[model samples]
Target: MKKFNWLLMVCLSVGFALKAQDNSMKKLREETAGKIKNAEKDTTGRLWKRGGNFGLMFNQGSLTNWAAGGDKLSLSLLATFNGFANYKKGRHNWDNNVDLAYGYVNTTSLGTRKSDDRIDMTSKYGYEIGKNWYLSGLFNLRTQFSEGYLYPSDTTREFVSKFFAPAYIILSPGIDFKPNDEFSLFMSPFTGRWVVVMDDTLSAKGSYGVDTGKHVKSEFGAYISATWNKEIMKNVTYKTKLELFSNYKHNPGNIDIFWTNIVAMKVNKWLSANVSLDMIYDDDVRVFENKETGVMGPRLQIKEVIGIGLTAKF
Candidate 1:
């Protein structure tokens, strides 16, 4: 009878231990689930409270009749998406945006009627690092397609050799400083690739041709931009931006292109207007009198454009 009693006692102890372990596991699972649920709730709450805006724009402009008397009507569509996380009551936090723009232009009086289509896409990632400093990086890609006649002044009147090309792919890593909530300044120094594709006749000239596959050239450049946001009325705001860029070619003797400056203004977050001035200073041009006949000097060209567009935000 004692042996049977001992066996019963052992079995009861094992059962009790198993029951306790099961209960402990259930409690742990419940705690973990609660934590996960709370985390998700917090994230959703933050996302709902953050402010975001989207916009689109279209514009048209032209220059005086100088060479081809060409007039251009350009239509642009832009979309911007931004998000902010960790917003404090009086402090700035992490913010980022993605910008996309599509543009189409129809040109009249340039030999044959032509159209140019362009797409510009940029991804900007930024984070506030300190009281007045921010770190940011941008990836930018621009492609242009143009179909028209080549060299209208040429005696040969063949008009079917133009090709489309990738205009630019730029990677900019930079920093920003915001002195106040209303104004910010940014700068980036970078090296990028600028490609220009041309027809077989132009490529055969050796001055503009693709070496192996496609036409590609490396360039070094820097850009500086400033933005200001001001609230003029209860629900109205004005934004302005100034940007400048400089490009240096590998061979300094070649022409150097510079976008002197660009000024843009936005009113009530809807209508935006801009003007740009660009110039190419060619150092390789020869200005001398012919040995037999008297000639002239070097010629300089300047290009300017003014644009106005409308935007919608959601």
Candidate 2:
């Protein structure tokens, strides 16, 4: 009888120990699940708190021989504003940007004195189709006011002309491919332009010239750009951009020009600089000649400019 009692006690002890272990495991699982749920809620709260961003930039630069007359002191100031908005749970993302740039130049010691002012504005809307592809369209308007002289006959004649002699409106539809987070390629294979208006005075002056009554009806072109960005240090990023702009025209003799290279750098998040160089190779029929010489030849010119600027981000 004692042996049987001892066996029963041993069985009872084993059962109790197993039951205690099972309860402890269940309690642990419940605590772990609670922690996970709390963490998920915290993450969602943080995401909801995220908001839009605002940025501004100011830039200034000087130019020499701005009008091919001689060395001149040129001053330019620009202001830019940009913003980004986020959607809660949508396939499409939206951003808004505005750029207001005004520039003025004063020429000194050149027989032909001149001053110029210009303004540019642009707007864009974009749709995110997938991870690395985007479709976007943009509209741009630019205007310029200038009072200068073209010393063609060794005489400085007062001349006042609007830089955008014929105001232009451009419609651009393009696609962007981002192979990775830090690089992108954009090709605007299709683009169109409309000359909405022209300065009456400039048009009248041109009417007496070789292009008499000829107005730019439409402009078709393609633009391609490649961008690269890298974080060289903790808060510093290095960036480079290359762009090409060309116009394919129905009238070959129209303004045939090409603008080729642009290089820029960003130091930390608030300071940046850029250099732009453009080349123009035109056909004989498109060339402007001096009345003295009837000879025609390709003209080669180089323009180099540098800029220093301040940037802010929010």
- Candidate models: Cα lDDT each: 0.51, 0.52
Off by over 4 Å in 2: 1-90, 93-108, 111-120, 145-160, 179-184, 205-216, 220-302, 307-314
Clashing pairs in 2: none
Give candidate 1's TM-score: 0.45
Model 1: runs farther than 4 Å from truth?
1-117, 145-166, 179-184, 193-214, 227-311
Report model 2's TM-score to 2 decimal places.
Answer: 0.50
lDDT of 1 at 193: 42
Least well predicted 10-residue stretch by lDDT in candidate 2:
49-58
Backbone clash tally (model 2): 0
Tens-digit lDDT track of model 1 for 1-314? 99999999999999999999999999999999999999999877764344444434444456765586546543333333323232332333443333333333344543233322334444545567787877866555554444434353534443432343434556667887877756767778763545454445533432222453445645667756566657665554555445544556444344333223444556656775544454544332233235566663333536454556554444
